[model samples]
Target chain A: MTELDRVIHEPARLRIVALLAGVEEADFLWLLRESALTKGNLSSHVARLEEAGYVAVEKSFRGKIPLTLLRLTDAGRSAFGGYKRAMKAVLGKG
Target chain B: MATDAQLRDLEQRPQRYWNADGIPELVMGLVWIIWGVALLVGEALPPGRGQQGYWMVMPAILVLSGFGANWLIKRLKERLTYPRAGFVTYREPGRSARLLSAGVAILTAATLAFLIVTGRQGGTEQSAAPAIGLILSLAFLVAALRQRAPHYLALAGVALMLGLAFGALRLGWDAINWMLVLLGAAAALLGAWRLARFRRCNPPSVEHHP
Candidate 1:
């Protein structure tokens, strides 16, 4: 049996990755709104994902306000893809 | 763990993000309105250099309206949506999306070319507006079905109905011109309605970087 990717198996990280996968890049605010996570919790999960090389983070300012952009890395996309396949195989239903 | 259906839903969510602001509809409305007015004005003008310049306005409207709408939408989102929902730069659609778009474009061109040739060969004067409009309406219908957006589907239905009416009635230039103007007005009104509702639902919140 192909084991699930531990990095993507966590529900919160999975949700975050899933959202990022759908778009080119999403800013911190967008993620925050979509994920409905508190600042601290979302940051920790994002930091962990970044550390694992699954997501890239860029910080900049939109005018005076700071904006943080997030995108799924190639590694991240591959990991997510692999995780999905593993899940599907485990479930044995398409 | 989310169910398979739930996962599928998540995957498809980004599409709903595209017209969240209703700005695209407003832009399209403006374009059609201008095109209709140009056609009407062209009808009255004498056949000369002046008429030629008048017809040229259609292309100018298309290009300018397209670019201007994009710029306006971006600015509006920056002010309205960004503060409330937060900012998101959506990922470009993948290869399949691009291929599908290209296919649609080619099909549309082919259909138009066929219409023009057949009409001319048959020695029948066929108005380009109704034919083109029907094709576009069908295209919108297909898109709405794919996206599963009810509002878009409704618009598609209206367009389809109008296109059929135009063809069946063998409408003249004047009738077509008025129809275009009405269509544009309807689109703009619908957009405004959606925009107001969207604003009510999504109130801007203080930036929280989480």
Candidate 2:
């Protein structure tokens, strides 16, 4: 059995990563809404993912309002894909 | 942990997000209405070089209107939608996919235009109106299925009914022109209503500085 990627194995982070995989890039608020995570909780998880080289974060302004944008890095996508395959294998559905 | 199926469903979120505020529908509705009106205006013109000139300029006007609609939708979404719902950009299609789409669109448009023109000139039974209806209905049906929006189903029905009604009337160019105008009006109103409801339900989420 292939070991799962620990960074994305956490429930909250898994949801966050799943949301990011759907779009090219999304703002902080977008991720927060979709993932149903508290603002602070999402921020912390995103920061951890950034440290893991799984997600890329870019800070920019939409006019005067500061926005934090996020996307799954290439490594993150591959990790998520692997995670899915592993789950499928475990479930006897692969 | 979500099963693999749920994760696949989550991947469709962006498409739903894009359709949430009805901006795309509104834009498409406006395009149909504008084109219908332009056709009527061209018909009303007295025959001369001016009429010929209007026909030539009509395509340019439609192209410009398309660009205008694109700009308006983006501006509106940025201010009205993103602040409330959230902001996400979808991936663009690959070059080959885009080229294929463009080719098909051109071919389809050319064929439809040719049929309508020749049918009118030959004074044949006006079958083009029903064809237009069928095409528009299919488009709305696709939207209904993809966006999970019930209103689009009504739109599909309206288009089909209008097309059949016009075809039955066999009133030549006038029937088709009127059908286009009515369909456009219905779509625009529906889109506007959906947008208003979306705005009412979702007050822009208070921006929390992360």
True contacts kept of each: 0.69, 0.72
Report lDDT (CA) for all predictions.
Answer: 0.76, 0.85
Off by over 4 Å in 1: B93-100, B120-137, B164-169, B173-176
The superposed Cα distance between candidate 1 and the true structure at residue A56, in angstroms, equals: 2.0
Worst 10 residues of 2 chain B by lDDT: B120-129
Chain B TM-score for the candidates in order: 0.79, 0.90
User: Per-residue alpha-carbon lDDT of model 1 for B84-189, expressed as tens digits?
Assistant: 7777776666799999988977987687568657766874433655665666577678777777666776676667667667666775546567668877877788
lDDT of 2 by residue, B91-132 (tens): 787899999989988998898778877886887648777888
TM-score of 2: 0.91
Worst 10 residues of 1 chain B by lDDT: B123-132
Error of 1 at B177 (Å): 3.8
Predicted structure with the largest lDDT when compared to the true one: 2
Steric clash pairs (candidate 2): none
- Regions of candidate 2 where Cα sits further than 4 Å from its true position: B121-125
